[model samples]
Target chain A: MSAVTAHGVIAPILVPLLTGTLLVLLRGSATPLRRTLSMLGVQLLLGVSLWLLLQVADGEILVYRLGNWAAPHGIVLVADRLAAGMVLLTSVLALFAMMHAIQGSDRRGRQFHVLFQFLLMGLNGAFLTGDLFNLFVFFEILLIASYGLLLHGGGAARSRAGLHYVVINLVGSSLFLFAVGTLYGVLGTLNMADLSQRVAALGPEDIGLVRAAALLLFLVFALKAALAPLHLWLPGAYSAAGPAAVALFAIMTKVGAYSILRVYSLIFGADAGPLAGLVDPWMLVLGLITLVVGTLGALASQRLALLVSHLVVVSAGSILTAFGLGGEAALSAGLYYTFQSTLVVAALFMLTENVARTRGAFGDELRAGPMLPAANLLGGLFLVLALAVAGLPPLSGFIGKVLILKASVGAPAAMPWIMAIVLITGLLTLIALARAGSTLFFKTETHARTASLPNVAKLVPVAALAGISLLFVVFASPIHGYAQAAAAQLVDPGGYLEAVLGAGATDNDADADTDTEPAKMAEVAGPRRTTVHSPPDQIMPAH
Target chain B: MEALIALVIGLLAGCGIYLLLRARTFPVVLGITLLSYAVNLFLFVMGRLSIGVPAIIEPGRSAYADPLPQALVLTAIVIGFGMTAFVVVLALRARADLGNDHVDGREP
Candidate 1:
């Protein structure tokens, strides 16, 4: 591999870190300068991520070791198809979010550009890191930035929502540490590639503890993904966020889904004899319940932003339901749905803000309001976004939902329920969006247009997002092809293992050590890996 | 020693969870703080309790305590500290802005 390809794995994390620090240092500088710098940073991030995606397009997993430390001993950032694609998705979403924030939302808050860059850094770090503990650190980074962004405008409602968001995530972080501890206690490594090998070799004595740890980790990710029973904080927290912040927050939930796909499929995969497919049944049931609850919530919402937030939950449900089906095709379908839904939901958040801007005192409420000045432009934008969100024909949402439904045929028993809930949720979303549209656009108080026209500059991002959704429909084949490749890479993580550790590393001496020490599980677990690595030749690869 | 550590962790977690379920923001923040303390201790113990052992590699050392969990706990402590500070400030702000301390921003 060329030097750039070898070292490019760290660029996505470094670029945003440097840019965020620069923005913070230059806080007293001109807003225009800061805005320009932030935009350049996000645009550069998008470029770097796209380049990384292309590098890994042929299914090469690139591992960047921090401090030249080898796997199982030091932190590494691995970029495979899934990680690269998710980072690219975040970069694309961040660019549009920056476009919207620069239009004026940044002026309403302190350090908007700084916080935005850190959020990107956190997201990229989370996607790329190969260490499970590093994943927890990145989760904290993103959550802290999100807390600041969510309360950027600072209101009673936002404060209320921010409290719940902060506290719940704090608890989640605690749970995450507990899980990490248990896993490390039982298996002697935090590196995911290493853990995948060790988890499979775990003795029967360690199975129950590892199972609990894995499930606890799942619960935390589910809370982040806004799956049911644990999804109570999403609508309130999302709706209360500032427009640009909410737009970026769309990918944050996908981070949870990404973790679920990564950890569950990699470590607790079909190869792990006792713990194989541990989360599959739970993922499906909770996913369907989340769909039902979210769709009903969307229908009951009295405000446009709340409705959009509920739609986000609906998308999460759909994507996870696809993932829960557990196969290459289902995962591919879920990935495609994730892409389109993120873009469309982000556009919906911005559109709600635009509508609220045009309606003066009746900000985003679904009740009848004064005639909007740019009714035609705004209404048309809302129509396309609503259609895409509701999974109607000729839009990307329809294509995604259809792909998921087609993939569900693999699981015979869950297929019917999946079909029923997914279709019913789509129908309910349609009804909700229809009601929100007419109430905002048609049910005007009077024909006399009183509210001022929204800035065309602000509408550009919304229009771009909607236009991309349309483009998604046009380019579904190639994009879905990429998703399929990524899914295939994910299901068979042997490449990931080989790239991070050396070739044939899973058959290392530690596997034999663990097998003989089953009786003294606790005492043996701590020093076994260390003993295996005492001879330097066995630890580091001959790179 | 293991039993004592486990008991402490269980007690702290039980109390933290109970406080977290309360309606007030202050108690909720306190609950999170207590829970984090419990988690940090729990993580510290996961490395296997060893006394007077080197945490790093050295000449002629055959036994060393697992140092990664200490490193992990240290990182967790710093993050938990930052989050607690932020949440505390946020709780005060929520109280000031909402004219109440209830998590839902209203007297129930």
Candidate 2:
């Protein structure tokens, strides 16, 4: 199975899944206590993740159920390295951001820490859950908390943006429901492992059903990930949502990417027979185009916040391309890039907030000019992240991109022209970042900029992230090893496949004996043959 | 049968998107509501559209619709209700917060 137990697997998701109710009930009592409890919760989550990562580092997979029911009959929580890694990453970003939240100068929500904590709980849970239904539930939990936080300070701009953000995600959630619902209808199973085994058995005549379901699911995720063409709502929505929201969102968007990575590579890989000609090739093409369009959008954006948001789109698209094209090296590279891009974009957005404060609120949009003089620290951090984003040399972003390019070079399934497009896109990205950097930091200003007030909470994390970016070259080996292990775990479906079919801890050896993955997984895992379904109002999927 | 439902839903979804592209708040809300329904229907059709068979299992019957989708739809319906309520309330707030109810928050 995966590197850990279902007990460990369910811990990350369950702790946060139900924590929101308590957080809401406890809201607005005392600022100090709320802040302390929230931070404690986040740190405790981090500790759980650290333990999970440590336990699973040697390649153990864990599966857990909410109640006592097994797959098809009950909800399952699956934790592979990839899913666990995301949990760790998301927890790190959210914890740091929450710390930044408690440093007060601006008017945050009255119970900002409470809402923020619930939001983190939701986020961590979403990343770790093994089931599709609960994925959506956690998604709502996160989104609902986001709603309160986004409109927490209650500004005209934030409220307006929150409306768009809330509505759009709601649309996304609806789409997710629709896709999952349809998949269940066709497969008769909701457990991901069960589906992975059974979905392949749906005969050739039913291929059309598979394609439609895959597309629906992909679309919902794409909208969340802000893959190009479908990414219409992101820039304005993210830019106006407040500093904490935008920074935290950089990692959140990757959950969509992570979902695609988990679903397609692991669960959907079982059913790739029908998807052979259609999904894979287009995914590569779409990914490349998304990368290009996203970078171009970032370049086109005049405002700093919007540019950072669009950059998230660009990086997500990069991960999408890498994940879709299944080369050993490419997948590893993509995972590295995904991690790098999330961290970089977060740092960049934090810088954007600082830049905005110094320049005053944009009357229309962020203008290109040397708004602040001698802003060397700010400029250097901005430039480093920009170059890293553009895939410049000696940086982690560049290394990751090079690995992706090297992986794509020989694969003939994609056109030589597709690689050309990605390359051209990379070059264009460098040019765009250069121009924006010059405009914002390097160029001379006609208008005198307002001085920025110091906030150690914000500055420490931003500086720490920049320092991490600088150490990309030095830290290459360890990072690569982690990425490699994570990728290998992903590509080889054995750990996960065995986990579901294998009996309890006592009989785990019974499964290992029948090591033939394909032959062992070919069974039909139809729904639990029960006469009664949980009645309409009480029904919940086994996410 | 699935294609027909998907097609009808697509048409309505297109209309909703058209309305969403407008500058007025009320039309955008209407569009979102309609589009949501279309999405729900389209997703249901993706399950291959079995007619009148209960997804729940029965004794001595091998054929049944998928219950997972039904469960998901139930949640979606509730979440959708929450969404509509949020949007409608936001609309009212937007009306109250801003002098006019324009889809674009800014008048200029």
Scored by lDDT, the top model is 1
- TM-score, one value per model: 0.97, 0.84
The Cα RMSD across the true interface for model 1 is: 3.4
Candidate 1 lDDT by residue in tens digits, A308-331: 999989999999999999999999
Which lDDT values do the candidates have, in the order given? 0.90, 0.69
True contacts kept of 2: 0.28
The residue pairs in collision within model 1 are none
Q: Report the C-alpha lDDT of model 2 over A386-425, residue by residue, as the tens digit.
A: 8888788877788878878777875875747657876787
Q: Flag regions of model 1 displaced more than 4 Å.
A: A447-449, A506-528, A531-543
Q: Which whole-number lDDT from 0 to 100 does residue A364 have in model 2?
A: 19
Candidate topping TM-score: 1
Q: How good is the docking of model 2, by CAPRI class? A: acceptable
Candidate 2 stretches greater than 4 Å from native: A1-6, A17-22, A361-374, A412-419, A444-450, A503-543, B1-23, B30-71, B106-108
Candidate by candidate, in order, the iRMS in Å equals 3.4, 4.9
Worst-scoring 10-residue span by lDDT in model 2 chain A: A516-525
